[model samples]
Every structure is written in structure tokens, then in C-alpha cells.
Target: MRYSRILEIVGDIVKVHVPATENKQTAICFGDLALIESIADSARPPHLSQVILLEGEEVSLQVFSGTKGLSTHSVVRFLGRSMEVTFSPNILGRAFSGTGRAIDGGPQLNDEPSIEIDGPTVNPARRVLASHMIRTDVPMIDVFNCLVESQKIPIFSVAGEPYNQLLAQIGTHADADIVVFGGMGLIFDDYYFFRKAFEDAGVLARTVMFVHQGSDPVVEGLLVPDMALAVAERFAVEEGKRVLVLLTDMTAYADALKEVGISMEHVPSNRGYIGDLYSQLARRYEKACDYRGAGSVTILSVTTMPGDDVTHPVPDNTGYITEGQFYLHDGVIDPFGSLSRLKQHVIGKVTREDHSQIMNTMVRFYAAAQDAQQKQAMSFELSEYDHRLLKFGELFQRDFMDINVTMPLEDALDRCWQVLAECFSRDELLMKDSLVEKYFPTPADTLSQVDP
Candidate 1:
């Protein structure tokens, strides 16, 4: 049904007066789509909008294209549906705007199947235990924090860190069958970098991107995650494809929510964000699931903490919803700050026998190395073991901790054994005697492996 009276035009929100009716057919539900048409100027194109707020005889819609060209006299036609995105095999290798319109200049997907966005998450009974791992060939992730299938985790980093590059690396090398990426408030260069990275790695054929640029309408940024997750859910359930969804800079997404909330005159909560921030975020992260008899959807998102403050509302709330987080700092994944709660599920079950032993030993030595370096910095006396620890620390950061280093999990495990042998004796490892005897390098081999 069409309502001719637009009550107010504030920013991108257009409030329309729809009289209350007893009939259920014409009831305006929140999140329903609307078409805003200019009555005086028929030549102007109609703008698509979504109902964000509904009160007695008053309905407010957020226009996707902005409200600069809209007037209070514009007609609002309710579409009786929420937002949706096109879904098909052809959607792979394609890029779409936040509003689900093709922006890559490729053929339009108007004929493809359309699926509704922001639906309820999978039921707990329908989900299976996440026992499988999604290898990204990055030792810090594969070796230390094993990313399990259907896990939802975020990369917590501040601006200026190479979080996007890390995300691109994961997207290119992740073992999942499909990658669905959502970029919120990304600049042109960052967006181009992701596109080129996927194309160069030859993964573009199996990837799909839904992006909202920094200059786009703020309301559009709020839709990118929903659109990307909707497609991922369909692929995992219907096609039985293991889908990995990557969203970058969720802080920008949360900021967009704050902006919309203020525009709608809603009372702000902590840090000027909306009151339902947790609910808004959990609705998306909870979408990660491994279907009992089908495939899975694993979400890895980036949430940049403003001013490097973990207490910031965006990262703070995100920390509660996600299973664990990878703390990215100084261009490396900080071993001490990062945690993967589900790594125990796959450490020895799916990986090499020495996986658990090597992981524990390597991190233990790295911590000692950090302490030894602190002593050296203070100009205190350093013991021979401290000297060995310093050497091990340097090699650890250069070989395994470096984000650019990529290798198979087994090779990484072997490298860990080699590094430990180079720094400390067999007894120093404190690992299982059987594992050390089988995997630890011999004294002669360690000497030969050492660089001259």
C-alpha cells in the first residue's frame, strides 16, 4: 500500500504518516522495504528504503541512496518485504554494493535467485561440534590458534596495522570451499587491494565480495554484513559448501549504527553507540555454524579498536560475542594476547602427533625469550641460557611469527622442533620423551642447520 504523506525528512530517514488500520494486510512491519517516489517530478528515479522505526501512525524509513533529493511530499510505497541479495553459483567472483546491487560492472544478477537477509540463526540442535580445522598456512593461526570450522573470531587491532593484508592472506589460503567477504567503510585503495589480492591468488573464482566504501551512504555500511552472511548461509545449507566469511573494520559498521541511531533520535548508550549494540553484533556472529549433515560457515572479522583502547564499545562488545580473538599488534599476531578457545578440539585429533607438544614448547620458550630480552635491556647480567633464549626469540619472530611466512602445518611443526633444538638441549624441551626422540633434531643435524 502507498502512503502519500511523508511526515519528516531528517538526514536519510523519511518519516511517513500511515494511519492505523485493523486489517493485518496493510500493517507496516519494521525492516520492510519501501519505494520513495517524487510526486511532483515523475522523471526522478525512485529510491529504495527500509522501515527502521514504527510508532502509532508514524513510520520512519532509511533511504539507501540518501535523502538529498527527497522531499516531505514524496510518496512511500511499502513493499511488504525486508532486504535481500541475489544468490547463485554465478554470484561467485562478483562484487556487489552494500545494497546488493552489482558494482563491479559485470552483468546484473536480476534474474538470479534472491534470498532474504538478516534471518534467524541456525538452531543449536542442527549444529554439529566444530572439530575440523580451516588451515590458512599461517603458523601463528594454524600452529598456535587452530581455526576450527564454524568458529567466529575477530582480529583485534588498531588502525595502521596490516589487518587487511592479513585478512587477504587468509582469504587466499583458507581451506574452505568458498569465501564471502564483507568490507565496511573501506577506502578505494583498500578495496582495490583486496580485489587484486584475490584475483592474483586465483581465488576470485570462488570468492564473493559485498562492500561499502567510505564515501557511500552511512546506512549502506550497516547492510554489508547482513548481505554477505545471507549468501554464506544459503551456500552452507543448500549447496553444502564450506563457506568462510571475512568482514573487515567492524568498528566502522558499529559507527554507522551509532549514526543511524542518532539520526532517528534514539537515546544513545555507552560511547554514543546504540543500546542494542550487543544484539546487533551477536545476530551476525551467531550466524557462524556447522550444520549437522551439511557444511559450515566460519566467520573471521577485523575489529579495530579506536585509540588502541580495548575498552572501546565496538571491540569490547565484540569480545563478548566471539569465541576468541587474534590480537594483532606491530604487524604480527601477538602470541601472548591472542587466544583460540577451540584449538584443543583439533590440535592432536586432526594434526600431527607432535602438534600439541611443539605448540606448548615453542610458546614457553618465546615467553622466556621475552623475559631475557627485558633483562638485556636493563643492562643486567645475562646467563648462557638467556643468550640462547634471545637467539630463539629472534628466529621465532622472523620465521613463524612473521605474517608473511606461510607453510603447511606439518612443516611448521617440524620447523618448531628444529628451532627448539638450535636453542636448547633435549631435556630443556620438557616434552614427551617419545615425541622428542622421534621429532627432535639430533645435535649434528642442529649444527648443520645453523647458519654460518
Candidate 2:
């Protein structure tokens, strides 16, 4: 409904005083659109802004770009609603900017009507427990740290790392019904790489990207997540499609949030960020859940810490919100730090019989190897056991832990056997006798592989 402009130039925020007295509501939600026109310049285009606050009849709108050039006598029209994003089958095989604008040079989409962003949360009663596994066909993820469906997790990395490559690879390989790509504050090259990679891998047919590049409006970074997730939820619930959402550089998104919060003069909680940081993170994460009888929405995001500092406000707050995180260092997934909290739910149960035993034994020996390295660095005596541990650690890191060593789960487990046998005698493994007899190599075979 159209209303008379009440007050303008209210210190960077335009206040449209209209009687919501007829329509009773608590607060005007984020992403709600408001059209403002300059009364003096009647022919001027409408200054599109979104509702920032609602106090009875007083509703404040934050201009998408800024409130510059907005005068005191501007006509304000509140749509009494938020910005709506279009989602449909046509979204597949297409790419969009952070604001839901087409960027792939594709034709316009007009089939499915759009739904507003900042969608409602899934009812607890309608949410099923997250136990199903979502495999990305990446050894670092599948064999060691399992990714469960509907789980919200982040890849903690640093700048100049291969986090984007990893995310692109997951898009190409993850076994999901649909893929939603949300790129926040991405460079133009990074954005293009995603489009090209998906198209090349043949997954673009099922992928939808919402990008907020470095050159675009900063506010779009905050909108990208909500828009992607809202569409994902609809597909999961309405069409029963398992949607995998990949968001890159969430730290950028957090910074954008902080920027807007500062603009509003909101009080800072931790590190000058808005105090509701945790809740905001949780609200988005909680959206990553499986519907009771429908499809699932799984979230895998990248959170690059400032200077690789996990204790920074963005990653620090995120650590508490996500189920677990994958730590990427030096272009490889670190086994010592990367963790999947729900791994036990799928590991050893759905994976091979040797999965649990091998995963455990590999990490255990690698730890011993780290100790051996320390001792060796300090010129300590290398005990016979220490020598063996050192060799095993080298082999483990080179074989199983190397990011370039791409192999299936069974092959990885078989390689684990090769390492275990090379380092110890049948009697030294401390494994079950029955299993040792089945897996451990004979003396003759050991001499053949382990040359003196």
C-alpha cells in the first residue's frame, strides 16, 4: 500500500512514518523493499531501499547502495514486504549475481514465481535427525572425516589457498540431487572459474550459483546466503530434491554484516561485530537440516580466518555454530585438525569393515611419527621403535594424507595395510590376531617390499 512520506534525511536512514496500526506487526524484517522518490525531482528514478527497522508506524529503510543524493522531501512507498528471489527448475544450469540477477548472459527466467528472502525456519517437528551421509568422492572427506547430510560445516583456510578449488571440486563430484553455489565477495576470476568448472564437469545442469563479487554492491554479500538457502529449502521441501549449498569466504560475509551494523551504530559485542553474531550464524546453520519426509539441505562453506587465526571473531563464532570444520593448510586437508563430528555415525558402519581400524591406526602412528621427528630434530637416540614409527609416518603422509593421492576408499584402506605391514612385524601390530593373520604380510613378503 502507498503511504505519504513522513520524514527523510534522518541521518543516512530514511524513515517512512506510516500507520501499520491497521496491520499489526512487531519488527520490519531484513530484505523488505521500500521505494522512495524525490518530491522535488519527480522524474527521478525510485531509490530502492530495504526495511531496516519497524517501530509501530515508523519504518526505516536502508538504501541498497547508500542514502546519498536522497533529500528531505522524497516520496516514500513501503511495499510492506521484502525482496523476493526467483527459484525454479530453470535456475538449474544458470548463474546469478548476489542480488538474483542473471550473470551468465542467459535468458531471463519467468516460470516459477519468486519467494521472499529471509524465509521462515523449518518447524522442529518437520525436521528429521541428520544421519544420512553426503559423499563428495574426496578421500580427505569420505574415508577419514565423513560428511553427513544436512550438516553445516566450514572449511577453515587462509588466503591464497586452494579453498576455491576444493569447493569447485566438491561441486563437480558431490552426490546430491542439486547444488546451490553462493559466492560472497568473490573476485571476477573466481566467479568465472566456478561457472566454467561446473559446465566442464557436467554438473552445471543441476547447479545454481548466487554470486556477490568484489565489484558488486557489498550489501549483496549479506543477501547471498539467505537467497540461496531459501531456494534450497523450497526445493528440498516441495520437490524433494537433496540440495547441497556451497558458500565461499564466509568471513567476507561476516565483515559485510559488521559493516552494515556499524553503519547502523549498533553496539559491538566481540571484536566490534554485532552481539548477535552467534545467533545469526546459528539461524543460517539451523537451516541446514533434513525435512522429515522430503529432501535435505546440506551446507558446506569456507571460512578463511584473518592471518590464519581461528580465534578471530568470524571463525571463532562460526566454530561454535557448525557441527565440525575441515582445516586446509598448504593446499592439503590436515588430518590432525580437520574433524567431522558426525563421522562416527557413518564411518565403520557404512564404509568398509577396515575403515575404523585403519583410520585410527594411521593417525595414531602419525602422532608417534611427529614425536619421532621432534626427537630426531633434537639429536636424540633413535630407538628401534622410534625408527619404525618415523618410517610409518613418512609413508602415511606421502600415501594416505597427501591431497594429490586420489584413490577410492578400498584402495586407500589397502594402502594402509601396505604401510602397516612395512613398519611392523605380525607380532608388533598389536592388532587382533585373526585380523593380523588375514592382513599382515608373511616374513617372505615383508623382505620383498621392505628392502634393507
- The TM-score values for the models, in the order shown, are 0.98, 0.89
Task: Give per-residue CA lDDT, model 2, range 28-125, as digits (tens).
Answer: 45557878887777877787788877777777777755566677667777676788789778888888877687888988775668987787787867
Residue 127 in model 1: lDDT = 84
Error of 2 at 40 (Å): 6.5
Query: Any residue pairs clashing in model 2, and if so which?
Result: 32-82
lDDT values, one for every candidate = 0.92, 0.82
Model 1, residue 42: displacement in angstroms? 2.5
RMSD of each: 1.4, 3.4
Q: Cα deviation of 26 in candidate 2 (Å)?
A: 14
lDDT of 1 by residue, 134-243 (tens): 99999999999999999999999999999999999999999999999999999999999999999999999999999999889988998999999999999999999999
Q: Give the distance in Å from residue 436's predicted Cα in candidate 1 to where it truly belongs.
A: 0.2
Error of 1 at 302 (Å): 0.3
